[model samples]
Target: MKSILFSTTLIAFLALIPAGEAAAQLIPQPWVSVGSRNDETTFSIGARALNLGVEFGLGTEDSTGVDALAFVNLPLIDQVSPYVGLGLYSEDQGVAVSGGVQINPTDNLILGAGYHSIRGVNGQVGFRF
Candidate 1:
């Protein structure tokens, strides 16, 4: 478990290096995301497809549960970008490391699915601009 977390963190850090540089040159945008992890409410805020972001859980079994996330987007087609992200979450079971992908259907709407160590499935919809 430690190794998995360490490796996931390492990969996320490595990916962020280029993302940070790219973000510096692009216009920053704000996005709001809401989802569920293990049937619990989840939320996130950040710029779409760039840099640092944060996510949190509401009504979570674990008190004060939260996750920090980093995202990078790749242009796939018009009005769509495929995104990859890493997340770390606090839970009653333990700290969790996770990664997932997001699909942007429109500039304002995003659909995502991912996995976490503590939570089995993650799904969310985000409004980005």
Candidate 2:
């Protein structure tokens, strides 16, 4: 059956990932952002592992939906970086694209501003805890 085949593929894919190595990434980056989606307010929480990040977004009550995003973080300089990503959203919002810059003035601090096709502009602050 189609479902069985998909399940097998999913399991196989997960099996190939180096779970232990990924969990052992040098820096544990946890961040949060507040933005807008189609003029409605949205908030997101995400984490970074080396050059990758994933975010989960929650929309306004009127909008009533969630978004999941995956990003590739590229370092541009010693204390700054730019990122690009794509994601899916609920409530028939469809796919969204995003790009942003992050500023790390100190090892324990992160500040960011970004634009999301579906989530609008957002500002973020993160730090080691």
Candidate 3:
């Protein structure tokens, strides 16, 4: 199941590079996106990776966590860009590094998959601007 998700994400990511490149030519700066962060079902406030950008969650939550991520945008096709990020998350369990890919299947939708340090796999979908 995890492999399937990762494979699908990779395919979608590659499919968008061409579109992204075309769009980049029209737009000077790269696109920016903001959305809710979640592990799977429960929504939480925190960052997944450092360079990926910042995310804040609304609600009551108490926990200290930090993650460092690096992302690169790839122009797959016109008006579409796919990006992949890698980073590490540290918490009570110590530290774990994770790698994931995000594909913008549409203008506002992002699909992604990541593996946590504790050997857990995560798949998520979020809206992006």
How badly does each model clash, as a count of residue pairs? 0, 1, 16
Please give, for residues 1-129, the per-residue lDDT of candidate 1 as tens digits.
999999999788667657755554255544545555667765544454344555554424654445666655554543434343444444455565667776657655767776655554657666654
Model 1, stretches more than 4 Å misplaced? 1-49, 58-60, 75-92
Clash pairs for candidate 2: 36-119
Ranking by TM-score: 2, 1, 3
Model 2: per-residue lDDT, tens digit, 1-129? 999999999678556557864454435688899997666787888777655678777654433333443444343465677788877777776777788987778968989999877768999999854
Candidate rank order under lDDT: 2, 1, 3
RMSD of each: 7.9, 6.0, 11.7
- Give the runs in model 3 whose Cα sits over 4 Å from its true position: 1-51, 54-64, 75-92
Question: Backbone clash tally for model 1?
Answer: 0
Query: Each model's C-alpha lDDT?
Result: 0.56, 0.72, 0.43
Q: Residue 52 lDDT in model 2?
A: 69
Better of 1 and 3 by lDDT: 1
Number of the top candidate by lDDT?
Answer: 2
Best by TM-score: 2
Worst 10 residues of 3 by lDDT: 55-64
